[model samples]
Target: MTDFAVAIRVYYEDTDFSGVVYHARYLHFFERGRTEALRACGVRHCELLQRAEPLVFAVRKMTVEWLAPARIDDLIEVRTRFVETRGARFLLEQEIRREGRLLARADVEAACMNRDGRPRRLPADVAGRLAARVRDETSRARSTGD
Candidate 1:
């Protein structure tokens, strides 16, 4: 599905001794953004896991770049986008920004797996929904040249 943006406030727990958000905390922000994006597309992780062919998504690889430090009390936005979709894998591009300046960027590759942790094809309906969302986003972008 098309990626979505989620806004978050940096909190004390997310920071390090230097008073800046811990490096690992950015991953948590990205995770929440992805989860909320999926929910917006009507795909709930728990509900998907309850299906006959239960599936879970796991990050296969990730490349992250830190451009700036975010501190507690900062209002940040996590923007996530699904860049590619394959048989049982997807690539996502995510960025964390504050006041229009990028703070961090990540390229994440994720795979869908069954309970046994083996790769599995996403359900046809799920794939269709995701594809439609992507197409809609593309069309909108084209129209707005965004």
Candidate 2:
């Protein structure tokens, strides 16, 4: 799960009058990327919600940079990495690229919360799974001198 990527085609609706993607549209792409990345880790939102004590992830903070524009009809890949997982929160780094060229980047912090909207620590198993991904990626990077 080092860098899970989901390919997305820029649709006409995702762009503005000039055919360039609207700044806000990148957020949608990033969100989709994060969702898919979690799914790749075998963490599905529906499963979390179905637990006896339901939980959901909410974005707590995000910082983004729009390095370049993605125009309609372009095929872009959203790469997401789960960098850290703590008590009730996790951090993600994401990038939108077109053919290996960076287009935008975002750093996000997401909190796990109960249905009542109060923060709740991630289920132990869930946390362990995410932490394992971080560890695996780190060890691999070190071995490869990345």
Each prediction's whole-model lDDT (CA): 0.85, 0.93
Candidate 2 lDDT trough over 10 residues, lowest sum:
1-10
Per-residue CA lDDT of model 1 for 1-146, tens digit only, reads 22588899999999999889999999999899878877887878998899988899998999999999999999999987767677888777889999889999999888889999999987777676666667777787788887
Q: Where is model 2 more than 4 Å wrong at Cα?
A: none
- Specify the poorest-scoring 10-residue window by lDDT in model 1: 125-134
Per TM-score, the best of the predicted structures is 2
Error of model 2, residue 64, in angstroms: 0.1
* Alpha-carbon deviation at 44 in model 1, angstroms: 0.6
lDDT tens digits, residues 34-75, model 2? 999999999999999999999999999999999989999999
Report lDDT (Cα) of residue 106, candidate 2: 91
